[model samples]
Target: MALDKKTIRLLILEDSQNEAERLVSLFRNAGRATRVHRVTSAEDLEASLGQIWDLLITAPSSAALDPTQAVSAIRRHAKDIPVIRLIEGNDSDAITEALALGAQDAVPQGEDERLVLIADRELANLEERRARRAAEVALREAEKRCQLLLDSSVDAIAYVHDGMHIYANRTYLELFGYDDVEELEGMPMIDLIASCDQVNFKEFLKNYQHQEGSAELVCGGVRADGGNFKARMHFSPAAYDGEPCIQVVIRTESDSAGLEEKLREISSQDLVTGLYNRNRFLEMLEPAVERAVNAGQEASLAYIRIDRFAGLQAELGLADADLLLSDLAQLLRARFGAQQPLARFADDVFTALLPGSPTAGAEGELRALLKQAEAHLFDIGGRTVQLTLSIGLAGLDEKTARAQDVIDRAHRCADEAGDGNALKRYDPADELAAAANRGSVVAMVRQALERNGFRLLFQPIISLRGDTYEHYEVLLRLLNPQGEEVPPTEFLAAAKEAGLAAKIDRWVLLNSIKLLAEHRTKGHNTRLFIHLSSASVQDPGLLPWLSVALKAARLPSDSLVLQLSEPDAIAYLKQAKVLAQGLEELHCKLAISQFGCALNPFSTLKHLNAGFVKVDGSYTQDLGRPENQEALKTLLASLHSQAILTIVPFVESASVLATLWQAGVNYIQGHYLQGPSQSMDYDFSPDE
Candidate 1:
């Protein structure tokens, strides 16, 4: 079984034993393992609460203990159990009351399917909460360990916030001639600098603040005892207690060991290229790979091999070939600079490690370098020779555990390119690899669709304009044999090629309608934003089937907001227009997501009566720039003028909220507020 699909520990607060067994069977039939504990009285409920329970199911009105008493007991115990109250019929009042009294949800009696869906949602949410708690505890422990290391260090280290001393280690305090930490705290760093070099130091600090890397300054220091000394200070960005600050380390010039430092540098450098050699490169790569795996840092590696190097070496003498290699090394150094780690790995192969580079950015840089190398003419002994490069790129992520594995993957990718000035990126699921098992994957997808092995995740779309209705964007995922959820981006293309996209879309629509209907019966006005694939948009029967599904579920047509991608709507404008008109006739709303991506986005909008337009996330991500902000504001103003509600996704932080609010964005959705989950549990009332 997958790590995510653990057995749920269920607590049932029902009077009848048979009903409890039936509920267990329902969950088991739906592919969920359950460890159930039935509670008939208050004592049983209290005892069960003592143990860890993932979900709680109770009767709305029972002879032994009602839901009210059960919920009260749960609160009294200070447990994080989700309660689902079962009502006798579609009793909206009872359901609403149960929810108001702190139940996660309420299900109608005999609706086994509805109950199981709600249970799955609750269990998933419970698991996420538990995982978050565990992560928090681990973070706290790690912080403690780091603090211990900092306190025990011998270096004179201090953390400064806004130029004032916030924290200083014992060594730092002693070096500053201060007896207690209180004396050193809240002191301006400028006060410790000698007056003669203070201006230059201030200028250095100002310049360092705008840069990406660290810098060191040699200046005169003034101690608390009115003594002076020559000191070297290294400044780097750091954070203390979750607030950004600058870390400062001061060492006296007299403590420097010049010979030792020179020897270390000589040992780490390559004689020919004057760059880091293989051993030093591996040493640097180890920590980078560790950071990428443990701290979610982004990094990439590029393996470049000179195409037809052996032929050139054979033509040129050995000395001239060495000269050519040296010339090429200079070019590499000038192109990559000191920011990235570059090394000459073998006779004709070079490696560059790009720290803090995403895969796309790394690819762009490598392609540009490849183009430059192809155009450059290397002069060796008055002989000009031009050569091409075959480069392979691989990203360092959590899946990359060993440094050697990353290099090996990149090397394999380069070899596969076959040395024609080709560039390839290492992908675990490459086309050739996937083609070998395409039949198996297609079978898995078909089986999932038939057996209801797909799961729907809901991400809340919050209203920045005070809309009170609960809104969620529906997302689909497939479960493999191991029960791990696979994102649609990984399998949807194959499904489309297999002619299953339309059928999959129908399954999502039917399930969404069924779930929404059950939820609405609990006296909540909920709306879902469902996405339509290109195949679904072009399918002539989709609109009719959707209408029938809505009517059968007895749901209001307006409650379903059908969404179409901008590209798909542009490609199939006529079909999309017809579908939009048909949905409008059914009293449903239309939304165009990833809008404003085309050369003329408004042209597509003019053809369809879309009520909502979700601007492409790139616009939101680029809001930090003034020009991008102006562009987004202009687009939002135009949409508002046309009476179209605007949604901006990928709002990652609170820093952009005021700007978005000023721009008149109707809704903002991102992980900063809440990521996609199995429940629509966002607290929209507070914003309203």
Candidate 2:
């Protein structure tokens, strides 16, 4: 490396024969690279001074050497190069006088170290100045390139700092209804921001300073025209001619205009009908709820899934069905307008976000709208596609509830509406099913919990090799006020639909635990089978509850086998595996009910670790047929290979039981051995 990092050449002039020799030696020995010319006499000094040198070094006695005159003479030849003085002693006064002559610096004679030090220092200072200049040039060129790209960008671009619009590109100027970019310069970005969102935008600006990576961010924005959209902004600290500056990038909403047009083609929208697509309609509901709450507006989301859209689709085919949907969407849109955001929620379903519309208003509008929607017809593919809407409305109090909660409520209402002549409102019905449920059905379940309206009946699961049974499957039952028995099929489905499945499933497990404990205390070696739902498996709480319940019931885990329906078995496979593993730890057996019943194979069986599989009754009903018997035998062979015992369910007759046994089924369940009965109070034994 060059010890002297000077950007320009330098030369020193001195006049003393000794002092001039000293100056010459000092300049030569200087850590920096410099040229020195020494003159001994005043005439030689004057002669040398007459020549150009970056700085003049002469004997102090050269009185004719006017420091200013010497400097001015040197400048005449080298007008840009600055000069410095060399003093014979450490005379602050003399050095000050030389500096006043416009020389950049001065150093004393005999202080060779100090002179050399100043030379090195000046050289470094010169290099730094040059470097800064180079940097400035490069930045200017780069800035020009960046400006070209920013101006040409299709999206609008602008830089807003401290609320003021410091800069904007041509595109941004056009977006703001301006003819030139400078038009918006110096204008507060706050002026363009929507009044309602000004405060929010201000708060978000504070975030840019703390951000580490790029400071680029996205936010919802408003155009000068008051149109709303989203934009992504990029930012960085910069400088303009030494003035602090902020650089920015802005993109307009028009870029999405194409996608919006294409998406509208399938249009989550109906043409003849102005209804929204099922997916798009759902998307609209969330924001509607937010708007209702934030704006203190009343709103309701109605999911009017047409009752038999499939039947409608089948009758009309694509062309006419599409036309019908378009017509329906349009009709609903017309009826609701600003009051609701209307769309086709489904093939047959038309939905709307009813605003400022209370339940009573929504109910009446929906009822009247349903009549109009049903009346609307379309012709295509040579047929008229006709349909009626099933409207299920969920009242949304955006203030405290979530979008999903409102949706779930709407679906539940739709479910209860059945065949569609009626409209159901949410916010009621299953309330009583909860701890605070007040609905009639919920009240019924609550009564069962309190008045012993709950009961258990064991369905037989007999070993094929044994003349009697292996164990009895315990099923739960609830009695209504009429003393009518409600089977698991009835209430279980209802419980799940009502979102009370977990509540009922838990109750069954707890009660069964008590029964098993009581039976064990009686010296019974009965194997108790309990059925659980996929819903219960997801209750992370259920696993721990089972743990405590089993210990409290004082029943060996293996003595209690859990039977899961095929659908439930498949749906909760992972949790089922965990549950099975926990049970297996206690040597417990796992069984699947109504097995081989899924249209889709319950492939999860490979991982369930279950030990028993029961065939649905539909299979047993046809056992006399060779194909049926062969199917049964094939299933049994497969299950036997996996060590999964095969059991036949609903064995209505001895022939069915015999066929199942002959087919290699290892167990039998149903009336053939013993009908389902509350008599499960008796201990189950293989020899029963």
- Candidate lDDT scores, in order, read 0.82, 0.64
Q: Assess every candidate by TM-score.
A: 0.38, 0.37
Which is the leading candidate under lDDT?
Answer: 1
Point out the worst 10-residue segment of candidate 1 by lDDT: 430-439
* Candidate 1 ranges with C-alpha deviation above 4 Å: 1-4, 161-163, 241-244, 252-688
lDDT of 1 at 602: 96
For model 2, the local distance difference test gives 0.64
